[model samples]
Target: MNQVTNHTECSSLNNAKVAIIGAGVAGSTIALRFAELGINTTLIEKGPSLVNGPPICHLHAGGNLYREISDQQCLTLLQQSIDTVKVYPQCVNVRPTVVALPLTDKGEPQDLLPRLEMLRDKYKALVQQNPSNEVLGDPQHYFRLFERADLERIAQRELPKKALCDEDWLVAFAKQVNFDKLKFPLVLVQEYGLSAFRFAAIVSLAIERLPACTLQTNSRVIDISAKENGAGWQVTTAVNNDDRVNTAHYDYVINACGFKSGELDDMLKAKRQRMVEFKAAYVAHWPQCQGLWPEVVFYGDRGTPQGMAQLTPYPDGYFQLHGMTQAITLFEDGLVASCEQSAQPKLPARFIKKIDHHWPEQLVNDRTIGNIAHIAQFIPDFTQAITAAKPLFGAQQIPGDDPDLRAADVSFHESGYARAEIVKASSALAAADAILEDLLESGLVTSALSKRYLNEHYFPVSLQCQADEVTARAEQLAQERNYPIALANIF
Candidate 1:
């Protein structure tokens, strides 16, 4: 077992109690930040464990996947992703992502150059501010471009025994992709992967170690009513398989309930606009490959027949695949929104079942096979892949009606109440920081800035050195959660 030392205990400064209802990415990050400051925090989750809401494998270092969004959002994502990498270094799969545009794509390679250059400059500045921020490698080599001819020649080279460089990582992909079907040039960016299981273990460990933070798993918040005389908020919770319900009081309450956040909003008699989207990624095994492959993105129009396709590689020949098409990763009626009836979005029954991780066996196999066939279009050899595990699927909450909203932070619903709406896992830290600022401003948490040093020095580097125990716990979580053990591994 990993031992997280008792951090600061600032309860004496101001015995402020905080209740965060949800242990997903946002809620977990918030709880840790509060615990680090020695604030009394209760992190409640309805699930069997933490961070099981969605499958997050890709770290959007620069919002590269969403070309339609603004450059500001891209910059914000880059900054937030860097912070996340520093916090949970073990969860990051340290490999570059190969981004290719198919011949049918309307976008040209030059369309990416400006943003790439801007991101590179920003990365350089960040690293200059702190040398330790170079988690994605040197800023000068932030991204590499390869022409069709270059890939054609590299494809003829022998497979590498072990990938040592970015070029080495690209060998397997270069050998497989059909250049005839792609545009002239492709680019590789310094993006990484986030193993959801590993992240869960890290956050769970961090929470359990802090004396100020209480992790309540299998506990659901059934009601949230304001306390009499407006002294504080009253939280009613129901534990798993327990006949009795428990009530608690807190100075502040946070609604971080992944897709069910609006339920809390409704309970507080506040209506807000939000949308829920159901998506999935299939797990497949292709043992025929001899070399390691980095994450790959094939861009296309989403929700169409030839939508954006993603291939995420893991150890031992396992790969997680996603296709933005309806028949593959997306489904009809998978997205719904709130009306005047209630604040929660009403997803169809099929999506809700999948969100509960109860997909029919035949449907899982069909989608896995479809994902394999789709990848085979680019890499003809991928047809030999077989389903390895159940699809990682869940519904995500988008703050507003626009599902394209990728950047989000803490929203003050009312006094003594905050709501976090993060569209991507990378935004977790930013959202947490916002709540921390709120705490400081409201005089709820009074830690000397120098005493706390809420910068990069918050988490001790010594704790991160205990990777063996973290990995062990992560693997156990994967098995107990009915996921392939390989999914817990850092690819």
Candidate 2:
């Protein structure tokens, strides 16, 4: 169990309360920022503190999981805004990987070889500027272009023999999986300096840091509605493993739940157009192979770099590899759309075929040994350490070169999602916009700076229904109840 401490309460909002559903990175970060600004806030999470999967895409990975709209610079500014709200230094860290793009079906190098050569040289120059070896925002460390020969040699010499590994194992180890000339996102978070965990710790730490913020794990929000006085919103939760129900009221309610955003949308009567869902994978790893991984690798052959899986270093010398897809518009309650493969992608089909063909036999006998041995094939680091290993889940012993992989049973902590292609602002930025728009229309918050920030930070309003209608109704409801419903004056 983790312990969180609260600080002195503030007098802002005259103690008016705010409710934020979901305790992931976005929710908790927002809550911390609000609390720091003297807003009384409560952050509600429906599950345990952390899951053994990947973190959100944006914080760690360089890619945006939402639509990639125009005005990409605003997107950076928005993230910087969230980082400002962070009580701790940015816990998320990204590492770079070399990606190969295919030029032809016959696997011949693309005619754009000269262009790629230039890019590779440019990338090397970038790395020289910032040599952290971790890929966060450092543009130089994000990605590099590699040639066909670079990949072919890696495949033939590093990958495991077909007879010894599972298909997935082979594909992953060989680096034969197509990861087009795409930039993948990777993140690392820490509980304390040098004590790294995944995104969950970051959220938990934020909640603990809040003075009066409550983080109820395993508590589910079953119902929510408007308060009678227009004072705020009322929320109900089922806790104690959903056996008990409790209700609370707050002056404002924020829906930051990821996939569950739609449920809150329904409760608030928010337009269905305001909610969207994209498909992502929750990836876990098999036991670690002895030996330190070389630079983590990513492979996705889909044309246009929809997404790619990459290896991320974990504490105690362990590593996690996961993949993500690009986010497309999802219909209400509809499945996330898949992407089409690139016309000429660099995915190594022969390598995949070899792995798939041999996987069944390996699985039939000595599955554990087979998985490790398979990974060892492509990763020279792992291959060198395969001998004299016991069947254990966590790392029993750490190799000299890798201090992070010494533990047994490391948690799975990688996540990827389909990203929105349009360059758009983050949700926080969007909220800022909503607030400004409300103020502008209501004639309450009128300031040049405020408007500038709103314009600069605001993402394209994507809500399907009329924003005007919703704003009007909310104002009317506030007026009837005598609360500060003049939300159009939110600034």
Per-residue C-alpha lDDT of model 1 across residues 24-136, encoded as one tens digit per residue: 99999888877776778999999888888878997799999888888999999999999888888889999899899998888998999999999999999999998988998
RMSD from true fold, candidate 1: 2.1
Best by lDDT: 1
- Where is model 2 poorest over a 10-residue stretch in terms of lDDT? 409-418
Q: Each candidate's root-mean-square deviation in Å? A: 2.1, 17.9
Best by TM-score: 1
Per-model TM values vs. the true structure = 0.96, 0.48
On a 0 to 100 scale, what is the lDDT of residue 259 in model 1? 88
Q: Which stretches of candidate 2 lie over 4 Å from their true place?
A: 1-13, 50-54, 57-90, 102-198, 229-231, 274-307, 315-317, 323-491
Colliding pairs, model 1: none
Give me the displacement of residue 439 in model 1, in angstroms: 1.2
Q: Report the lDDT tens digits of candidate 2 across residue range 102-215.
A: 222222233323433443344345347545322233333233334445444445554443323112122233453343432222211111111113233444444455564666
